[model samples]
Target: MTIEEQIEKSRTSIFKAVFPNTTNHYDTLFGGTAMQLMDEVAFITATRFSRQKMVTVSSDKIDFTKPIPSGTIVELVGGVKHVGNTSLKVHVDVFIEEMYSSQRESAISGEFTFVAIDEDRNPTTIVSYQ
Candidate 1:
């Protein structure tokens, strides 16, 4: 399914985190760091839906469109974009502050797949959204 398809009718979570002083150098957020945040957001969204812990199985693709500055608000949005027998594909959008304007711009976007696990650490079907 397309990116819009799954999220259009799926559940998700909206998480916000600020860039820490140690999170950036020269006031610019690092791409790797941004991607890690994206993954976490995606996991939170998917696992919350499943009502259990999950592990990332895969990611669709990611692109960095802008730079995030330190001391700015970073908006992390993630949602279920697709679901399978034992997995959920999620989409994440990370936005950075526009500094002076305090506006938000898309900094990075990624899609990841996560599988719910039971107490035994075995893969489990996330049937809530099904």
Candidate 2:
């Protein structure tokens, strides 16, 4: 498949309900929790795109634009942004949706970098999957 096709096919999205347990004392989703979820989505995007062993190398700037309160739903979408010889970048966006109303907005966004690895855990060129 072409690189564009691979990227489009590898787009990933995950949804979760923001419960009290995952929220901070202020009744909003914790920043750390958001980062963790973003990383998970970014990892999945990288793996799906390369279809190989991938590990997170670094996380770029993460911007929290809005607060996600408890009792809301969140959708995390991840897409491949850049691909290198042995590394790739994934951009993740977290959107908040109100449970009782038709309200939705972007709450966070970030970029994560991952490196393809071989069995020996050495960085390897990303092989295009059929």
Candidate 3:
């Protein structure tokens, strides 16, 4: 497969339902919870793209554009944004959808950097084996 094909194939989307337990007192999804979900999605995408043991090194600015109320469904989309020799960047976006209505909007977005590691947990180069 080509590098473009690999990147395209790495695209991932996941859906989650927000419950009271995962929300704040104001009934909105917690920022920390959203970040955890984003990081998970980033890890999966990075692993899929590199086909190696990948670890998150850093997360860029995360913006919460809107509040995600409890009882709503959220879709987290992750895709490869940049590819490097030993690391790559993944962009994750969170979209909120109302449970009983047709309302939907972007709740949060962020970029995460992941580094490919070997068995010893040292950084390694990522090569696309076509």
Candidate 4:
């Protein structure tokens, strides 16, 4: 498949309900928890795109534009943004949706970098077959 096709095919999206256990005293999702979920989505996108073992190396500026309250739903969408010889970047966006309404808004966005790794844990080419 073409690079563009591969990128599109690897896009990942995950949905979760915001419960009290995952929220802070303010009843909003915690920043750390959001970051963890973003990283997980990024990891899945990177691995799907490269079809190789991938490790998160860094997370770029993450902007929390809005608070995600408990009793709401959240959708985390991840897509390949950039690809290099041995690494790639995935952009993740968190969208909040009300359980009772059709309202949805972007709450957070960030970019994560991942490096493809071999069985020996060494950096390898992202697109080995290509």
Candidate 5:
């Protein structure tokens, strides 16, 4: 497959149910929890894109635009945004969905950079099918 096709096929998404245990005092999904989930999704996206062992090196600014209340559903979507020799960036977005309706809105977004590594944990080049 072409590089574009590989990246397109690497797109990953996961759905989660917001529960009271994950909410904060404001009864909304905790920022830290959302971030953890985003990072996980980003990691998956990077791995899927390259089929390599990858580790997150950094995370870009994360913005929370809306609150995700408890008892709701959330969908996290992740995709490869940029590719480099040994590193790549994945963009992740969290969308809040009403359990009883079709209403959905973007609640958070962020970018994470990951570096491909070899068995020795050293940086390795990412092979692309161009």
Candidate 6:
């Protein structure tokens, strides 16, 4: 399917983690925290397609385009990009909204691969819901 088709089946969410007053000296969100959220976003997208547990097998590429200030809002959007018999690939993008503004800009984006597994943790085919 085309990238646009994948995007149409995408899911997006906004998440925030409190950084106590002393957590940031520069008053910006920590890079590590941002990455954690990014991973979750990717996982969620893949899991939605699998309807089961998903583990990140690989990250194709992750590019950080900007920094997100501490008090700003973070948005993570993810969707399926491709699917094989037992594997699904998801693309996730992270964005940040300014404290006093609604504008959001891309902060980072990555692609993750997940393999479907059964209760025994063995690889299994991921059926298409479409």
Q: Estimate each model's TM-score.
A: 0.76, 0.98, 0.97, 0.97, 0.97, 0.81
- Candidate 5: where is the Cα deviation over 4 Å? none
Tens digits of lDDT, candidate 2, 16-39:
999999999999999999999999
Which is the leading candidate under lDDT? Answer: 2
Off by over 4 Å in 2: none
lDDT of candidate 5 over 44-130, digit per residue (tens): 999999989999999999999999999999999999999999999999999999999999999999999999999999999998866
Candidate 4 lDDT, 1-130, residue by residue in tens = 7898899999999999999999998999999999999999999999999999999999999999999999999999999999999999999999999999999999999999999999999999877344
Query: Which lDDT values do the candidates have, in the order given?
Result: 0.74, 0.97, 0.95, 0.95, 0.95, 0.74
**Higher-ranked by lDDT: 3 or 6:** 3
**Predicted candidate 3 versus true structure: per-residue lDDT over 11-66, tens digit per residue:** 99999999999999899999999999999999999999988999999999999999
Q: What is the Cα-based lDDT of residue 8 in candidate 6?
A: 61
Superposed on all Cα atoms, model 2 deviates from the true structure by an RMSD in Å of 0.8
Clashing pairs in 4: none
Per-residue lDDT of model 1, residues 1-130, tens digit only: 5434435544554545455643656567776777788888888777666667799988788987876767777778887877777888888888766555757678888899998888998998766533
Model 3: how far residue 51 lies from native, Å: 1.1
Candidate 4 TM-score, true structure as reference: 0.97
Which residue pairs come into collision in candidate 3?
none
Clashing pairs in 5: none
Prediction 6 global C-alpha lDDT: 0.74
Better of 1 and 4 by lDDT: 4
Q: After superposition, how far is residue 100 of candidate 3 from its true place, in Å?
A: 1.8
lDDT (Cα) of model 4: 0.95
